[model samples]
Structure formats: C-alpha cells, structure tokens
Target: MLARLLATAAVGGVVGFIVFHPREAEATGPTATVDADEAQRWLLGGNAWFVKGGRHVGDTSVERRTAVAPSQAPSCTILTCADSRVPPEHLFHAGLGDMFTVRVAGNVAEPVTTGSIEYAVEHLGTQLVVVMGHERCGAVKAALSDASLGPNLDALLALIRPGIGEIEDLDEAVRANVHAQVAGLRRSAILHHAEAEGTLTLLAAYYDLDTGVVTFLDSPPTSAVAEAAASPRTPAEGHAPTH
Candidate 1:
C-alpha cells in the first residue's frame, strides 16, 4: 500500500471515509488522554450529527471553557487546508479542545506544521492524527493553475505542485494533494516514531462541501506507511496519473 500510495500523485474523484486508532494515555498535566479508536467514534458520530443538522457541538459553556482553559487535551490532530469553509470542529461537531488543528493553504506538513502536531502527540497525549482535505479547496485550485500568485502563495503552490502533477480535475487534485500531504506528515521523525512504536493512528479524509460528508481516505498498513515515510523523495518525484 505504501509503494502504491507513494508511486502515484493523483487522487481519484471518489471519497474514502474514516478508520484507525490512537496511542494510550501518556501525557501529563491537564492534558486528557484519548483512545484513538474512541476518538474516531466521537468524530464519526459527531459528523453524523452534523449531517443530520443536529446541534452536537460539544459543551462550550463557560464552565466547559474554564475546565479546558489551563491546558488542552485534544484527542486528534487535524491537518487541513485553511479554507474558511472547512472548520474541523464544526464539521465534526467537536467541542472545546476536542481537536488540535494545524491549518495551512494546502495542508502541507512543513517544519512548523509537523512540529505543532508532534507537540500534540508527545506532550498532549494525542494519539490520533487526521489529515483532511476538502472538495473545492482554493489552495488545490491554486496549485493546479498556471496563474502567477504572489511569492508566498507560489512557494506554497510549489509544495503542492509536484504532488498531483498536472491533473485537471478538481476532485482528483484535492484527493491527490491530501495523500501527498499525508506522506509528508509521516516523514516527521516524531510522528514516524509514534507510528512505529504502536502509539499513533494516522488517517486521511475528504470533506464534501455540498453534502457535508467526511470520507476518510484508505490508509496503508503500519509497516508500509513507516517504510514509505522513511523513503526519500525529491521535488521531481510523485507525478502520477489520476485513477
């Protein structure tokens, strides 16, 4: 699965849904210890509530806020695009500090991004990592375009450009970018160690803006993922066809 995943850069138009479990409680202080499987349940169930139009946003009352004010013990770390439309908490109906999020234009796991997630995993006792990409993502659209964005935007696009190649389909592009970013996250030594030691659960997801459905991308076996992340890649790599 890692070889196949690494070999291709294009994401199919199909949406894959949720899976995986997390680390056991290892964090100290006010951080809450969350079971990865249980956390997945909350996210999946919360999404159900979201799709049903039920208000399931976890407690946000002053007391709830006060309790989590000292320190946050999020169950999962979500690395997703910074698109305003795809708020992880609202989409999953999660409440205060239920998740720790790292948002970027294309959800790229650059140095700082990886570091933030690592902090959650090592210090906060978060055992699960969910890397989500949404449909109609502006960052992806930008990456697919030939237009001249500013320096920073271009740099961001540079990171995304090689992931999906020249795929013209937006859905395909979004899917490809998500997996590529997942690979990038796995490259983090801290994250890789966590996965290798059986203390982490990594997953990919697709968010449909229209239907409000979050389809989790299929992940490879643990060993495969670890091996693939350990493998090196250059800027010229991963220009695969859309399936």
Candidate 2:
C-alpha cells in the first residue's frame, strides 16, 4: 500500500509539473489591424462630430507622445486644396492618426499626388478617399483669369486647367473641379483597380465655406456636367453637357 501511494504521488507531481511548466509560454501577440470597413465608419463618425460642432481639447502633446511609443490608427485619406480656409482635420473633426491627408493647390492630382494617394490606399489600407474642394479655390481662379504663373505655379495651373474648361460659371466651375478630380482618381489605374475589386471608395465633395455644410456629389458620373473652362473643345463644342 505504501508503494502504491508513492507511485500515485509521483504521477500527480509529474502531471502538476507538466501543467505548470509548459514547453512554450503563450505571450500576447500583436494588436489587430483595423479593417477597411471599420475605418470608413470611423471617418463618417468624425464627420458627424464635425456636424455637431464637437470640440476636442485634449493635450495633443500627450496624445502624440503616447502614439509615438506605439502604433496608431489612420482611417481615411483626404485629398484637399491647400487653401488656408480648409483645415482638413478640424473640418472633419478628426483627431490625430484618424486621417491621412494630402493637400495641394487646387487639390490637383498629378503623378506625385496620385502616388501619395496610392500609398494611402495600397499600403495604409485606407478604405475611403475624399477629394474635397472648397469654395473660391485660388488655383481655379488663376486658371479662369489666365494669370501668368511662376514655374511651379504654372505646373499647378496646368493640372487644374482641364477641369476649368468644363465649367462656364465660376460657382459651377468650383463644383466641376471637385468632380473632375474625383473622376480623375476613379480613372486612375491604381485606384480603379481597388474600386473594381471593392477594396476602396472615392467620393467627390464640396465644402461650402458660407453654410458650413459639406455637400457630397453623389450624382452618377454619367449625369454630372464637365466644366467648359477646363475642356479642350471651344464654345462651338455645343452647350456644356453634364457627365
């Protein structure tokens, strides 16, 4: 009976050791990557916050310090004009790491701009791309006035010229510019592939500085009108038709 008791104790001790001293300790893995759909929802939520006039007064330095030590979440890519009036983060009421933004005069999409956007969508996995154009864009005005631009300014104007030709009226021109940029992005090889594969969405939007309301241009591309000021065809090209 003593021998049987010793054997049972040895077996129990062995089982206890096996349970306590696992061959491989399980450590916490990396944090999960934010999915594209979740990112989009976050972006819309930020916009809703803006619509409600929510204020974020937290210490940015503290937030930045914390995020610097680890990873952060970026939900959307906003391509907007360089107009001082349009502060992307503030307008969208987005906090740090909530948006990946690209700004250029007239919000023109050239190779460099497109490359940045491609990086955001392809590498950063941003699901929603907002092409935001604001009221009275200087670039559009310059294009309309045929103002002589400096070297860099010339290149900028060139990018916006096509869109200008599509609109006869200045107000319409502004809206058309947004539409043109959106269509340009849609036709972009990288963006088009992602859109076709249902990986990303491109939205064209105009921000009314007066009303503080952002109107999304949701009309089908076929129904939208191109600006006459930006088009190649002359006035003889027939009444400026809608897209």
Candidate 3:
C-alpha cells in the first residue's frame, strides 16, 4: 500500500510540473512598443540625477521599454577611435539617438570618412562634428613603432604617421592625431563649405582613460579656430611658420 501511495504522489508531481511548463507558443504575450521622446527625457534626467549623486527615479522596466524605441536623428556627429575602452555613450553620458558616432582606428579622416560626415551634416542636420582621440592609442603606437607594414595597413599607418611625427611625446602624439584628423576634416570641401557658412562646427577633443575626463583641445571655442589657423602648414617637421 505504501509503495502504491509513493507511486501515486510521484505521478501527481510529474503531472503538476508538466502542466506548469507550457509550450513556447502558449507562453507568448502582446508586444510592447516604446516612445522615443519619453525615453530621451528619462535618459537625460537619469544622467543629471546620477551626476548630482541622486538615486534612479525609474526602474529596469522603464529602461527596457526605452531600449525598444527607434532612435531619432542625432544633433551631433562624433568621429572617434575604435578603442574598446572609449565607449562614446558612457563617456558622454548619452542614450540612443543622442549622438551619431563613427568609429575608425586612430580616428583617421579619409575620403570615405569625410563623405559620411558630409552626409550626416547635409541630410541628418547634425550641427556639431567632433574628432576625438584617446590616450595610449594602439593605432598611433603601431604607426610610431612599425616602419614596415603590408600595403593596406601601411596606407593607414601613413595617415597616422604625420600626426605621430608632429609630437615628440607619445602622450602628445595622441592629441596631435586628434587635432590633425580635425584639420583634415575641416579641409574637406563639404566640411569647409559648412564651416564657412556656419552650418557646422568642427572641434577636437582628447579622452583620458584613467581620469574619465575629456579635455577639449580648443576650449573657449575661439581658441580652436585660432589654433587651427596658427598650426604650421608643415606640422610634421615641428617648425612654426614665420610671418
């Protein structure tokens, strides 16, 4: 009798488990949609709250909902290095659609890169373009260290080499690379026209990985224009041009 009772109990438990574990088709629910503007507002508020040492006003559900929304057009375009350490969203405290970002090794502005920037400016209506670089950049380091590379890499290294050659210090070389890329972007016909017409503003910045701080090379706005203007034409040679 006891054996029969134990068998009956086991049967019941097995039946209960089977009933509770529904098939995949039966477990689905209605899809949830997100509102982009509300998400942006929440993200902006969250950043401000975090900066002020305040608690999260919203919960994970809200963030999850926000994640599903379509990203709106970005007002700013950033051309930055493809470094794992330098995540643009985290560094800028931005959420989806807040900034349009293009990442390349060494943040080199080749023709293709400039073309993308032009499309963003002309179509997406991004008013600001930032060319950013970071400390201990591996691309810049490779260009500095390696004298010989295969054709494709050598071409990339050539672009980075001019900037590396401009600065004696490795640390300064990183910043010089950022400034050089910014100059290269500015000189592009599309960007130059945009700048002259005051439709776009181009700036360069350096990211400090250790400190989590971004220093604008051309702070005060005016200084960037002046510095770019004063920068020697033959920057790689390290000689300031005489009047």
lDDT per residue (tens digit) for residues 1-243 in model 3: 432232111110000000001001011211221222222222233233333333333222444234323222444677888899886655554433445678888899998788777766765455678888998998888787766778887898799888668566778888888888998998888889978987777878787777655556775534332333222112011110111
Candidate number of the best lDDT: 1
Candidate 2 lDDT by residue in tens digits, 9-82: 11100000000010110122112234444443334333434444546421134534344223333456788998
lDDT of 1 at 58: 58
Q: Against the unseen true structure, what C-alpha lDDT does each candidate score?
A: 0.68, 0.58, 0.56
Sequence-dependent TM-score of model 3: 0.63
Candidate 3 deviant stretches above 4 angstroms: 1-71, 221-243
- The order by descending TM-score is 1, 2, 3
TM-score of each: 0.77, 0.69, 0.63
Off by over 4 Å in 1: 1-32, 219-243
lDDT of 1: 0.68
Clashes of 3: 0
Report the alpha-carbon TM-score of model 1 versus the true structure.
0.77
